[model samples]
Each structure stands twice: as structure tokens, then as C-alpha cells.
Target: MNPSRRGLILGAGAASLAGPTLAQTDGLVLNGRFVQGGFAMGRAAPRAIVFVNGEALTTASAAGLFVVGFDRDAPPYVDIEVHAGNSVGGRVARRTLTVAPGSFPSTRINGLPQSTVEPSDPALLARIQQEIALKTEGFASRADADDFRSGFAWPLDAYRVTSRWGSQRVLNGTPARPHYGIDLAAPAGSPIRAPADGIVTFARPGMHFEGGLTLIDHGQGLITAYLHQSRIEVLPTQRVARGTIIGRVGATGRATGPHLCWRMKWRDRNCDPSLLIGQNAPENS
Candidate 1:
């Protein structure tokens, strides 16, 4: 068979095992299907847990089984671990997996400086704790799933990318961590728009690390966050349309200059925002 035809057959075979199926002994790939089914130990009520690269994933149940999609831009060879949590406590109870590369388009990130912190200061630690809490809260239950799947657009126009997502950084010449969001270099007071239709979940001015921040729930556990804004034009619980002007760019909190940091999350799993925009999004809007 031709290479393209062989790949199509393989993809079809993988998709056929949609419901409870056998787990691959090797790795899972982004946008790829695999059979990951079994009973997990430790919970009195039997709660399912999934993790990718040590980060827990929020899974959705369907047809007597659970299914999950890897982040569209996840790195190659991610480890997937499953466990069950209960009222007693949590324990690791399943297999470890390695993820391979699939057919998703690759993204090239640019323009971020390397920086790091010891994370030793009490204040900084506390702030980190707070941010963690916010992320872990999950998406709003009322969010509609159809809205997010419809499509997305660029949230801003005429801006240069100051930082791209997934860039490993060295803070103070020491390796720190990877950047998780795409930052747009815009002057303070420049309009920042919404990428999709959603309801505002958070709108707070001047947080410990994020400066002014707004989080919009785009349904189906998908959320978009805007950080380091100089002004917030939306309110909590407010419904916003795609392309709505929700805020303005600014240097807020720990940032050194005015910029818009755009972030996307599926539950707690972070994904790159650039993958959702059209080719003409930056140039036309």
C-alpha cells in the first residue's frame, strides 16, 4: 500500500476502538487514539484519574469508558499515568505510557528571554500557591461545549509576539522552566479582544504575579486567560462574544513592559493559543 493509504488504514483502526479497549504497552501520541482501559485501585467510589507528563488531565466519560485528547502541541514522548482517587486518599494504580508524535501541525515559538527564580521567597511561594489554586478549580460547569468547538479567532490585532509558548527558559542564567503562554508585545492601552465566545469567570486587577488578569470560560473545560493587562473591560459572569474588546495591554504585576499574555487551558492541561488562530488572523485583524 502507498504510505498515505497505509496511514489512513492505521488511523481508522485506532479510531475503531473508541470504547473500552486494550492499552498500548508503549506511548500515546497527540491527536492519536489508543486503548487505555482497566479498573483502578484505591477509591471507595472508583474515580478515574489521568495524567500526562506528570500533569493530571481532566477526562470526560463516554460509552462506559473515558476518553481524552492530548494537547495539540504537547511534546513528543509524554508519559501518561492513570490512577484513582477516593475519600480515603489517592494512590497510583495503573500503567505508565509514552506518547509519540502524530499529524498535528508544528508551531515555532520566538522572542522570549530566559529567566528564572529560586521560588524560595515566602511571598513568591504564596503567590504561586494562589495561582495553582486558581488553575485547579477547573472550568465552569455552566460553560457550553459547542461554543468552543465551533472555532476561534485571534484576540488582538497588529502586535508582535514577545514570547511564544513552550520555550525553555534560563532565569538569571540558570535553567528555570518553559513558557506556557504566547505573549503579544503591545503598548499599554492597546485593545485586547476575546478569541472566542465565552463567559468571564475571573476579572481581577493586579494579582501577585499576573498583574491584571481575566479568565474566560469557553465551554467544554476549555478556557482562555489574558494576563498583565493595564485595564480590564469585562466583569465576572459576563457573557462575551468573539472579538469583543475585553481588556487592554499593559505591564502589570511582575512584568517589565506592557504586553498581552494569552493562555489556553483544557481543564488544567495547558495548550498553545497560536494553534487556534487562522493564518490571516495576525495580518487581517
Candidate 2:
């Protein structure tokens, strides 16, 4: 890797992936959290084609920048490849990385309305399905901008973490899917800010599970979602900069208390939002 280029740094509390120190290549530099539910930013020769597991996930930016993410249930090892130049004097670099599994704890929450935990009403179930479909469209937004290069910040000035990413959740004595978002406990109506520059792809004031849901596309399939909001201030196609107030925290959805469920996604892969705090995007040499 080039000595002048820098990659993202994870927060102090983020779990670091354990692995052997693999040799770095000068042709392509990569860095960031490498564990399951983590993220990584990369830099390669300008116009170079990058691939993960033989599939071209993304092409490098004009400045040779790009990003990738690991899902919550990502496998133990990942394969990366970069190809540059043509048939004459071409350059290729390959790297195999060992990723660490997420250490999630079992969490049990009682006293919630049984309907919220496992809705039995056919009408309510249909509404939930519609809401999920809307969110799916929001996650599909992919703008050709580099707004993520500005990096991310905490959405709230101060809050307590009530639930972490990838936690095994048991609600109302029924085991549920692992939580994919970080739940920040804040007073109702607390201001929520945009974590990075991005264009709003979806914003609705009402949803069965995610009240006042909102999603922002930070370019190249990197999207962030805010759930259980008391108020939604932005609209679809709106552009917002970091620290811009976008909404207010609340318990309007299935939540038992006032809080914000913050989530991040790189394409379809879910990632840890807390890991991006205070991290800067990678730059070319």
C-alpha cells in the first residue's frame, strides 16, 4: 500500500477482526473494520476494476476510491482482486482476508404488546409487508456521487446505546431475527442530524414497524436508514450535509421507549453504523 494514503478508522469500542498480517500491495490499498457487520474503504489505480470473490462489486472512482462492506453473517474469509491496464503490461493484485465473526449477546425484552412482537391480524401483516417493500426500494437507491468521501458523524449529540448491532433478540418470549441496527436511547423529540452528505431516497411519516422512516443514499449503493422518528423534516430527493437536522427521535413505532434505530447498508449487506464514527474516507496517493 502507498504510505501517503490513509483509510478509515473504527471507533475505540468497535471490535477488531483477528487475522494474520497479510502482505499489502502497492497497486491497491484497503482499510477499515474487517469483522462481520463491518466496512472497508479502498483505493486502486485510477480506472482500475475491482472485484470481490470474482464479481465486480464496484468500479474505482476518478480518484481511485471505492468501498465495500461485510454482512452480519459474512463468512470467515474474503477474496479481493484488482485489475488494471490492458493486455500489454497489465497489473493484477489479489488478497485473501480472514474476517472475524460478530460477538452478539442474547437480549430479552418483555412487556411489549404482543401484536407488535408477532402481529396476527391479516390487515396488519399486509401493511407491514408494504412498508418493507417501500424500504427495499429505498435501499436500492444508488447515486453516482462521492458524498461518502466526507465520512460520517454521530446522528445525535448525546445518547445512551440501548441495543447494539447483530444482537439475538427475544421479544415477548418469542425468538426473533438478530437486530441489525444500533438503538440509541434519547429523550423524545431529540434532534437527529445527517451523519454525512447524501440525497434522501425515501421519507415516510408512518410505518408499522418503523415510524417516520427515512433513508439517505450516500452514493454508490451506500445507504443509511433512520427509524422510529418523532418527526421527519426531509423529503425524497432532498440533499443534506453533515450535521444538518433531519428528524427527531421517538418511540412511534414498535419501540417500547423513545429512541432511534440507526442502520447502514452497502448494497444489500448490513453494516455497523458505530464503526464509521470519526472515520475519514480513503484518499489516493
Worst 10 residues of 2 by lDDT: 2-11
Q: In candidate 1, list every pair of residues with a backbone clash.
A: 27-98, 28-98, 28-99, 115-171, 116-171
Which digits, one per residue and each the tens of the lDDT, describe model 1 over residues 124-178?
6787788768745634443533345435787888789876665665545555456
Clashes of 1: 5
Poorly placed runs, candidate 1 (over 4 Å): 1-69, 72-116, 138-142, 279-285
Model 2 alpha-carbon miss at residue 131, Å = 1.4
Q: What tens-digit string does per-residue lDDT give for candidate 2 at 1-285?
A: 321122333223222343212234356666666778876667777666767777877666667666788888988777777777521135886666556667889899898888889899999999989888888999998787767775789999999999989899999899999999999999999999999999999999878888889999887788999999999999999999999999999998788999999999999899988877765665443
Task: Please list the C-alpha lDDT of all candidates, in the order they appear.
Answer: 0.55, 0.79
Q: How many backbone clashes does candidate 2 have?
A: 0
- Pick by TM-score: which candidate is best? 2
**Given candidate 1, what's the lDDT at residue 50?**
53
Clashing pairs in 2: none
